[model samples]
Target: MSETLTPERVRADVAELLGCEPAEITPGENLFDRGLDSMRVMILVERWRAAGAASLEFPDLAECPELGHWTALLTGDGA
Candidate 1:
């Protein structure tokens, strides 16, 4: 289930988990500050891993709870 990881995609996924509209999720906003909990983060991690992002880890998302950062990390465009 490999697919391109884009900021839009990340935003959509995060929005789904957070029960908000994608437009409400800012690319640079901190997801944790927006109510993203550990359970949701793990759910996202598993989903991404299943989508071929095996390198993804909880801390990778936790340390940086921004959509842009997650997109870059999953897409291999950021550190």
Candidate 2:
């Protein structure tokens, strides 16, 4: 079975995976420009896929490419 996708969990994972503080990930923060590299993005993608379909990936994660995007993904809203 797959783990559930929860907003709090997602935010925590994103923070850990990107080496950022939770507060650094506001709703409109930009991962790339803010310091998220392609390599890190790839790692995040892989982790997401391994986590099952409930995980978010690159393209889908690229919509806003900001904190808001990540916030939306974790909250079950966004594309």
The C-alpha TM-scores of every prediction are: 0.86, 0.70
Candidate with the greatest TM-score versus the true structure: 1
Q: Worst ten-residue run, lDDT, model 2?
A: 70-79
Tens digit per residue, CA lDDT, model 2, 1-79: 6665556656666788778777667766677777777777777667666666444667877666675666566556542
lDDT of 1 by residue, 52-74 (tens): 88888999999989887898888
lDDT of each: 0.84, 0.66
How many pairs of residues in model 1 come into backbone collision? Answer: 0
- Cα RMSD of all models vs. native, in order, equals 2.3, 3.0
The alpha-carbon deviation from the true structure for residue 68 of candidate 1, after best TM-score superposition, in angstroms, is 1.1
Model 2 misplaced regions, further than 4 Å? 54-57, 74-79
